[model samples]
Target: MDIRRYAPLRAAGASWKDIAAQAGCDWRTAKKYLSPDAPAVPPRATSRAGTVSRLVDPFTDVIDAWLADDPGLLATVIHERLVADYGFTGHYQRIKVYCAEARRRIELESDAQGRPPGLHRRFEVVAGAQAQVDWGDEGCLLVGAGAGKKVYSFHMTLSYSRDPFICFTTSQDLATFFDCHRRAFAHFGGVPATIVYDRTKTVVRRHVAPGRAVPLHPQAAAFAEHYGFAIDVLAAHRPTGKGRVERQVQIGRDHVLSGRRFSSLAELDAAFAAWVPIRRGQVHRTHGEVIAVRAVRDHAALGPLPQFGYAVTETHLRRVGRDALISFAGSSYSVAARAADGRVTKAGQRVEVRVGVEHLEIWRLPVDSPDRTPMLLARHPLAAVRGQMIVDPQHWAELPDGHTRSTTLDITDHAPVAAQQVPGDPTPSSVSGSMVFGESQAALEVMVARRPLAYYDRLAGLAAPPEPATTAETTTSESLVGAA
Candidate 1:
């Protein structure tokens, strides 16, 4: 303690013993405190924490210039630019250190007026290698004669070129989901190897434990099989896993939908179409390359498109009605009859009906085992008009002769016929017989009533039914008729 007051005397050339005698401390202890080389002469913990530095000094000035131009420059960007522009060979840690110091200085000078700068790695992928897809709600589309309609906006961006394709749909059902993919692939001229998606209902069936495989919607699996692409589903609650498409959704809201009035869903789609070329034509802020130029490289790497796309089918779970009938889209299609006696159908049995643009397929899962392939009960051409009942003939053929002989109904036919009877035993004229007592009329009525089935048999033998024509034969006959 005495060294504190007498330490100043040592600077004036006082000897250690002379200073110790004045301060009442031992000469050895005083000499220790007074020694110029003594470690105890300095106060505890006063040294700076970040005093060490690697002399990669030139990049600091470049970083400073970048910061001066843009006060929000990120350390990572500065490091990237340093390497690319000035051929800086210093370790990135050095630039990071400089950036931290620079940021602190900038923050202190601004007194909390500016937002702190941070950087994220901009991911890049080969053009056709991968794409990120997501569906977003774009509020209401003011269209038609009424109020605004809710729209489900679909966004997809090629991971490599940042080239984007968008479609605004009315619903996010699996068919619409597949349709969006088809349109995106067509727009890109080829399908990517992988399509990344968040855990959407259309893509993922349910969540399970971590590292377990996610079950995909059956239609999604079929669509992927048809298009030859792998489905990449991110873990639940991880939006950043598919960050590319998520960012595009934000960009779309800002640039395409923000402050804009669209009359219809189609108009919204057209807006996206028009914006795409402009988006791809500009130089990307992160890549520092023209999007159009990058897209050229992207297309070159994409897989060639298939010759034919899948005929998308909308799937619905339906219950089989009695008489093996299932109704869909305001029409009824027949599955096979359950019994010849018209007792019942496989009623209450769950059937999966896939209604396509052209056809309807009824699939029934086996009662014994749920995992087995579903039995395809029937497929009928989808009716173009409502209230039409479509029946496959082979289904009816399994019934008894009496039931099988019933007439086939074609809703598409417009012909009309009066009720057929060989003769009537009584007529309205006979109800109250004003003109009834005529012998000649009685004879005529008797003769008509006596007409027999033999008469129709003779006529049927004379006139044979013509075979039904097929699609190819019809086309050939039409072409022949045209030639003639």
Candidate 2:
């Protein structure tokens, strides 16, 4: 049967009945074979042309080469090439079939050759059991005029709970490190069973050898001891082991730190304090509850705070001056009078002054003085000074021989001299051009003129001029003062 000849007859619209009768076959056989609905037989064209075997051989290699040059090259190109070069005149769909088979072979080969070598373990964590910690740098800026501020953020996360805490500090020193941890633990309202950390130089010394253990730095060990928790050190350079904190650090930078602007470390800390509560209250997709709620539940499982306080203490080395006082952060405090001429150690939240087996509490010095010197006195002397400073001069009139007017004159005479001598400077002093004293009527007039209207009005409403000094008291004071 010539299918090509039938093609022209089929295109011309000749009925199956007409073709079957002309072909001299039984009507039933003709209808069964020629009807469009009849099952298709294999093409006879290829068999007659004797080209089928060559077209099928090496078909995969041909398709692969064409695809390698351009994976998106059309199947029609291959079909056209086959027709022009190898006399392939089969239907277009036959070429498509070969192309699909070729694609399957290439994919199988790629799977065998390019697949990753080993399986990856999924990350799993226990809720509230452990946490990860890391430090990230934030660049320096002038927080205030003449105030150079450099800040770093301490980041922590509970492994399973994905709860996060961040604290910004001006230093990464041991004290700051401990302070951050203390605040973080308090914020979470409990401590994790274990804390994971990178091999930071602040925490760990150098590794003993590759694949071996490293020693923990003493300060860091003390911090862990204070918190009463064990530390897990990730392998060197393996930050992914502490993936929770690493991810938290990034999120903190984007969501917390970047969203706010601050003018000082204190301001930044305040802003972070406000942000942390909101962050803890946010629902975690995996945990299905807010971090704060989960943390509270876990807190019940945590061990109680130590009977003896183990919280970190700030340490500072200060040199005691000849007056037996040490200066710290622009304030001076007494150690031992003998402690002068040597270095002394101080530690604790309050200034601790060590005087030969005894600890002295340093009183906060007044900021109003021209010289903001911290006054470190023996406890008894401090008590007396406090009593005297607190008592009003007007109230001193009740004391024996303490006439208020004479007392006022004595205080005024000694005020500037006492101020100069307290700072221990003996240099000769002179009043500046701007320094006006009330000794001269002209100077007093200038002072009154310069005084604010409110002050002058308040002074005018006073009951009377301060009682004039008694002549007997003045003559006695003049005689005593002249003797000096």
Candidate 3:
């Protein structure tokens, strides 16, 4: 009955009589069905095939128009359109098959032109000799405790070493930007021979007549100069020149920064520092050694550090407020009182406050002063007052109860009496006070238990008692009475 079953019987040269007996059919019936040369039985007509043709032929024109315009249109959409427009009632599978064939035809036509060309490969640079520097803004997030924290990711990569250093910060100002470089240098323990950079506004002044290298942004130039290294800028719009660092930025985002939580910038920075060592220890798939080890071998070829810190010109001028304040890194710092209402010009590491033409050096600035207490204020005061505390055992009882206030008074008492006098100048005064054996509590208990009976009588009268005299004051009073 089927072609596959009859083909083997005919191929074996079995007569129709034997085939009929094996197949359980009459000889005449088997002969009529199995004979390949028997006039083909006039090609029996299939009702189902006719039904399929009828359903597809009616929608062929509409399907062709849709395929020409949008070959990506789904089969279900085409079927619905056909049913609404042309009264199509075929199953969805047939339309899907037809659409697939149409898509194949479209693809064949599109690829007939062929691809343009393969990417051109360039000469490779020596390993660890150079590095590329650039910044990428990876959006902002609230990253600190409580609320309203600002954070940004800073990315850097070595051109030849392919080592990457990523950091998170609340600022992109010169201080933080330079600080990141310092950290990176310290991490690798040496500076790169030549650092390639892009024309960021923070680093590039101008295009220098269309295509020439723009002068380095003063601060960035100073950083390079301090380290005794050279900086080269890539041609504008040619990001591929710095492709190594760019690729590293993506890798860092995927592996280190993604799905990590940090409560503060300090916390994030600590986590990043921890991650750097792990990243550095990993052997590059292309190169054999770890990136950190490679950088160390390459660092020996670098130049020595410069003697003087590099000088940088001011890029912007901002006015100091009446409160002696200037803003940087989304935080405020107060200059000296003399520098208030003056013009403050910032150049990389230095901030010069000008009153007319004269420059006032600002010794200290308050960094952490929100609604909360400022930590820098306390630290600065402590540093300024170090090594000036009085340590006399006799006057310990007369000192104040509060530790900070007591320490402050001790420094004041031991300070030079005359403005021009240097430290350790002796004062001609006798010291006589109870030596408090322990802390303030012990001294207070002794004073309460050992007070004279006359002292309580004076207190009961509610009268001002005679003032106690120091040894010098008593001697002066007696001498004055004798003179009188």
Best candidate, lDDT: 1
- Runs of candidate 2 with Cα error greater than 4 angstroms are 1-121, 145-147, 286-289, 311-337, 340-484
Regions more than 4 Å wrong, model 1: 1-123, 144-148, 236-238, 312-314, 320-350, 355-484
| By TM-score: ranked, best first | 1, 3, 2
RMSD per candidate (Å) reads 25.1, 21.7, 19.8
Whose TM-score is higher: candidate 1's or candidate 3's? 1
lDDT tens digits, residue span 189-259, model 3:
56778888787776777777544557877777777877867888876556887887888878877776678
| TM-score: the better of candidates 2 and 3 | 3
Local accuracy of candidate 2 as per-residue lDDT tens digits, 1-484 = 5432454564588776677666655556556665667557723423544445644454656668887666657788888887788767677787887777666666456454554422334576555678889998876633555155567889888777677778887667655676687778877777778888887876786666545777998767876787778988876545678877888888887876674566776676676677777878899877688878876766666555555545443334444344445554444444432112232323322333322211224432324123565544223122211113222233223235534443213323342321121111112223322344345512211111122344444466743334455788567645543432
Query: What tens digits encode model 1's per-residue C-alpha lDDT throughout 272-360?
Result: 88888888889988788998899898878878778888866778888877666888878998886643334334666678898764568
Instruction: Report lDDT (CA) for all predictions.
Output: 0.73, 0.59, 0.59
What's the C-alpha lDDT at position 465 in model 3?
A: 68
lDDT of 3 at 451: 36
Q: Distance (Å) between predicted and true CA of 154, model 3? A: 2.6
Relative to the true structure, candidate 2 has a C-alpha RMSD (angstroms) of: 21.7
The per-residue C-alpha lDDT of model 2 at residue 390 equals 22
